[model samples]
Structures are given as C-alpha cells and as structure tokens.
Target chain A: MIWDWAFAFEILPVLARAAIVSIEATLIGFALAASLGLVLAVVRIAVPWTGWTISVLVELIRSTPLLIQIFFLYFVFPKFGVVLDAFTAGVLAIGIHYAAYCSEVYRAGFDNIHRGQWEASIALNLSSWTTFRDIIIPQAIPPIVPALGNYLVALFKETPLLSAIAVMELMQTAKIIGSDTFRYTEPMTLVGLFFLAMSLVSAVLIRSLERLLNRRTMR
Target chain B: MGIRTLVTLLIVALGVIAALATQEAYSLFLPGLLQGAVLTIEIAILGSLLAIVMGVLAALARMYGPAPLRWLATVYVEIFRGTSALVQLFWLFFVLPQFGVTLNAFLVAVLALGLNVGAYGSEVVRGAIQSVARGQWEACTALNMSRPQMLRRIILPQAFVAMIPPWGNLFIELLKSTALVSLITLSDLAFKAQQMNQNTFKTIPIFTLVLLMYLAMSLVVTIGMRLLERRASLGLARGKAA
Candidate 1:
C-alpha cells in the first residue's frame, strides 16, 4: 500500500509525454506574458491618460481566478464571434493573467530608475527613445529578469488548470490514466515529482541568471 | 467626455449589456450562484486558517528546531510549493483511497489547499522572522529570556508586522484558488457556474456573471485585508513606542 515500484516505472514515460505539453504551454504563455507585460508597463507610463483604464483592467485580471478567465474566453468569446481552441484559450488566459503580474514587476523596475538618469539624458540632449534604449532600459531590465523568471516557474505550475478546458496537459493525462487503470498513486505522485524536479531546476537556473545579470551590469 | 466619464460610460455600457444578456439567467440561476459563493467562502476561510497554522509551525520548526526537524520542514515546504494545487487536490481525492486513507471531499479540499498555500506562507513567515533585527534577539537573550519567551514577547510581534502585507496577498491568492475546488466535484462557485453552463448552454452570460462574482469577492477580500493590516500595524506601532 505504501509504494509500487513497477507501476511508478510504467507511468513515468506517460507523464513525460504529457510534461512536454505542460512545458510548451508554460513557455508560450510566458512569452506572451513577458512581451505583453512590457508593452503594458510602457503604455501606462507613456500614456498617462490611459493609466486609469489600464490599471482597472490589470486589477480586474489579477483579482479573479485564472480558471474563470479561461472559462470566459473558451465558452463566452465564441458567442461574440471569436473562437479559440482549448490550448489557445488556456494559453491566452494564463498569459493574460500573468501579464498583470509582470506589468507590476516592470513598473517597479521602471520606477526604480533614478531621476538622475533622466536629467542626464536631458542634459546630453539625447532623444527620449535613445535615452530609454541606451540608459534606462538596460538599467531597468536586469532586476526585473529575476522576477519575470519567477513567473515562468509559476506559469508551469499553473499549466495543470488547462486540464479543465480539456487541454490534455500532464495533469489531465495523469488523471485519465488514473481513471482507466484505477491505480492513482503512481501517476499522481509522479506528476508531483515531475513538477518538483522542474521547479527546483528552474529555481537554480533563475538564481544563476540573476547572478549573471548582476555581474554583467556591474561591468 | 473626460477619461473618468468615458471609463464610467464604458463600465455602464458593460453592465447594461450584461443585464440584457442575463435577464432570464438572473432570475433562474442566481440562488445557485449564491450558494456556490457561500461554499467558496467557507472553503477559503477554513483552508487559509489551516494554512496559517501549518505555515507558522513549519516556520518555527525550520528556524529553531534541530537538524532532522528542520530537514522535514524544508522538504514539506519545497514539495508543496513546487506542485500545482490542482494536482495536489486530485492526488488527495483520487489516490488516498488506494492507500486505505479515504477522506471525504470537503476535508480533502481543505487539506490540499492548506498544505499547498501553507508551504508558500511558511517561507514568508521564515523570511519575516529572519528579517527581525539581530539586536532584538540579543536584547531578549541578554535579559535571560527562554526561547519561547523571547519568541513570543520580542521576535514574533515585530516579525508579524512584516508578514501582514504578504499574508494579505496570499489570502487573495487563496480566495482565487477556491475556484479550483469545483473541479474536484466540490459544488463550489465554479462548479455551480459550470452546471449553469451545461443547463442553459448560455456560456456568455453565466461565465460573465461568475467572473464578476469572483471580482466582487476578491475586492471584498482585498479591502478587508487592508483594514486588518492597518489595525495590526497600528498595534505594532504602539508596541514599538511603548
């Protein structure tokens, strides 16, 4: 009752295939969030007029569950003449939900850029674009990378929720296997271990990246 | 129109559209949604209470206990934090019976959510406790205080201040996570909304209503937490000044 070695071995390969979908969803979703979040952060700053609306939108997204957002996009959007497959809907919901978090991280980085840098840019008669590209962005981005990396790991953990919309992600596949064979322990435990391995490896990778970014900036 | 006015207009238009879309749904399924909302709240409140307890105990063990206890705490934290709460719930619900540890659905939901959230909360607690000034620890020790007295009288109060904001954030996260319980057949808010979707096939209105309901509850939780934080910080300030 405590352990089953052969069954665990049996499920490992099955879980691995499903893990690929989980990884893809995480990567694509994170890519969407990272780029969209940067755009959102810059837009809010550059267009103060849109700040309130954007803030409201971000807050609304952050406050609600990703599950509801997925449900809304999957089911409701079609009624309004937009259609998305399960994978796309899951990716979009997760990506958008995390964009709200990423935006705050970007905003923090942007805010941390000191007033002196802006004055220096103005003194040199550097165009705003040149100033941002040359000075502000380079300084703003390094500290933000670590935070962004954390969201990547979080997005990976959240990939399981895609199972709800029938995405056949790692967790869903494991659930299916469990139901079919009535051997729940092995597959479920393997999924947890699967997540555990990825999470630890990501954490280590992010730490090293953070260290690298700090060193590069120091030079 | 000004931006505020425009934003207001947009929101009003959305409300009008929702009202129009959900005319029949409002009458028919409102109670079901409300019942679901109540269950969601119950699960969230109880789960969070258990999480805080687990977090504090784990933090305490990690910080002050000997080698094996610390290792146990660390392993618990990492495993729970690393995994998905949804997967954790499924494992508890589906897998436990195989091992002859069959609990009911509600208890499983609470345990899974509590353990998942408690892991993260333990880190928060540990970080806050460590961030308390070294001088405070030395001062208490120099006064010949025992470990328990030192922690209770000196360390915990200050550390508690730093822990509140993060705890508030975790609370909202927990609230949003309650939506996942519906997948485990918990009859929560999300489950009822799914039932509505199946029955009416009106995904638009039902899901939109559920979304708004979640938003409303989240707002309540956030505002309530802010008030709690303010009250707690005021007490902290008084303690420091005294």
Candidate 2:
C-alpha cells in the first residue's frame, strides 16, 4: 500500500522496454493515418461521388467505438485467412480508426483554403496534382499540424487498448508484471506516470511547433 | 460512370452482403450487443449530464469565483485535458482500488468519462457564455436585475442554445469512449463483440454486425441532434427576422 521505491525501480526498466513498443506503434500509426487521411480527403474533394462514399465510410468508422474496431480487426481478419501479428493488427486498427478523424482534419484544411487560390490554380491551367502539391497543400498544412500533433498524443494514449488484443504494449506489460508480482501499485502507477510524462512532452512539443509555424506564417 | 465509383460500390456492397449473410450469427450476438447498447446509452446520457453540470460549475467558477477557486478549476481542466482518457480510466479503475476506494467498474467508467468530457465541455460552456453580447449584460444591469436573475433570465437560455452543437458532438464522443469500459469488465457492446468472437471463432461477421449496429445508433443520435439544433436556431432566426 505504501510507496515502494524498490519495486518502482524494478518495474521501471520493464515498463520502459514496453514503452518502446508503444512509441513504435504510435509513430507508425500516425504515419499511416496521415497519409491515408490525406488520400481520402483528396478523393472526397476531387470527385463528388467519391466524396460522398468517403464521407459515409468516415462517419461509419467514427461512430463506432475504437475498442470495437480493434477487436473486430484483430479477431476477424484471421477468419478471412489474413492473419497479422498482434503488433501489426494493433497498429493497423488504431491507424484505420484514427484515419477517419484525420480525414476530417484534412477536409477542414482543404476547405479553409480560399476559393481564390483554387480558381487561380485552375486559371493557370495547372494540373490538379500540381495545384494541390504546389499551392493548396502548403497553405492548408500549417494550420492542421497542431491538430495532427494532438492526434498523435491521442494515439499514444490509445495504445493501451492494444493490451486487450494481447499486443504486450506498455499497459499489457505492466499488467503482466503486476499480476505476476501480486503488486499492482508500482506497475500501474509507473504506466500512469509514463503516459503523463509522454503527454506533457508532446504538449510542449506541439506548442513549440505551433509557435514556429506562426512565426513562419507571420514572416 | 467511372472506375473508382464502381470499385467503391463493389467494396461497400461486398461488406454489406457479407454482413447480411451472417444474419443468424448476428441474432446470437444481438442480445449482448443490445445490452451493450443500453450501457452505451446510459453512459452517454448520464455522463453527458454530469459533464454539463461540471462544465457549468467550472466555467462559472473560472469566470466569477474567488481567485483560489478559479485556480482550482483551471488546474482541474488542464490536468484532465492534458492526459488521455484511457490513462485516466485505468488510473481510476485500477489504481484507485489500491487506495481502498474501490469504485465499481461502471461508476469508475462514468466518473472517468464525465471528468474528462467535463474539461472539454467547460470551454464550450465558457465560450458560449462569454460570446453573449456585452450590450445584453449592460441592459440587464440597467434594468436592476440581480446577478442570479440576470443569468437565469437572460444569459443561460441563449448560452444553452449555442452549446447544443458542440455538446451533441461531445455526446457522440462519449458514446465511443464507453467502449473503454470493456477493459474493466463492463459488458458493453465492445465486450460482447469480443465474447461472441471468442465463442464462435468467426470474427469478421460478428464485428461487421457490431459496426453496422453502432452506425445505426450514431446515425439516429445525429438526426435527433440535428433536429434539435434546427429547432433551437430557428427561434434565434425568427427573433432576428422580427
């Protein structure tokens, strides 16, 4: 019941090892979400029909809870004869669920671009790809970087849900260590501390990025 | 007319058909899913109510209360907002028990969610109240209306209306966050899906059904919210028009 430094020291290394897995999942998951979200946003904007479909798909994904989605993917895919490792399944499910929200962020970014910019791009007879890459993307991305960075922090916190599917991430590793030692206090507390530390770091990093982006924009 | 549309249609059609073909399995899972749905609704409704209350209190305290009370409220908001809900949930459910304050899983889930959502909702509530025109407050003061009376008669009604859309979205987010409760052994919809998958070993169909059921629930909520928003905004529009 008391604060035990000895136990805390013992669990810190184990949890830190598991923390690496969490960091990996978060980075890969964010990368997947960012790219896929951008593609979905582009598809939705350029083609009306595609937009409608993507909207529906995004809403469907958003409406459902992520725990269910992760469960579904981890359990269901193997039945269809495509078995993924726990880590891959966890990352994929998290990536896919978050991509729906990121797509919304991207859509907002796209919408916030002034109509004049689009008209000008079209006026120059530039291809859609060139216009997006050269003008629209540069303008849209700055405002969204903060939002995307927030999602990265969000995705980091959500890595615990991977424990449910047996991914042995930080939370799962902590749970294992706790159950084995019959001492939940140290491991669980350490996990909470780890999350708190990482979240604080991410928040500070995001604020600095926002400031940097603002300075660049002002110039 | 184009290949992309055709491909999307094909994928969607296939997903739906696959969902329907496993109708019997859905029947088996429906009871559990429905139970989970009840929990989901309970969490959304009760958690939202708690959040609104906490949000209003926090906002009011920050805006008008004593300095220490304002600091307390600000600290609460920052801590909850800066942390993840999942971590908060775990700390509440798992760590709190070690302190001999063993809350039930359902209560733990509700408290964790309510507290987290309350932090976000406080901002919405605060902004909505602040955005009420300064002239309106001056008018109330000239009328010699007491502070409480002015708030009740003039400010809150308008603020509540403005808070609707963001609150609606928050309700949806609350609905989704309820799934995390399954981790603490709450038999919510997500838990049921996991159970059904374990039993049948047919993961895809059961989950597809769950996805559709969730979609149906969210769509219904969205429609209801939209109607309420329209009704609220219509009153404002009519006032403007007059």
Candidate 1 lDDT over residue span A57-106, tens digit each: 88789878999889888887678788889999999999999999999999
TM-score of chain B of each: 0.89, 0.88
Best DockQ among the predictions, by candidate number: 1
Which one is best on TM-score? 1
Interface RMSD of each: 1.0, 1.7
lDDT of 2 by residue, A1-219 (tens): 467899899788888899899999999999999999999998887777887668768877888888888887777677778998988988998999899989999999999999999999999999999998999999999989999999988888888888888898898898888778877788877787777777788889999999999999899
Instruction: Report residue B225 deviation for candidate 2 (angstroms).
Output: 1.8
Inter-residue clash pairs, candidate 1? none
TM-score, per-candidate, Cα-based: 0.93, 0.90
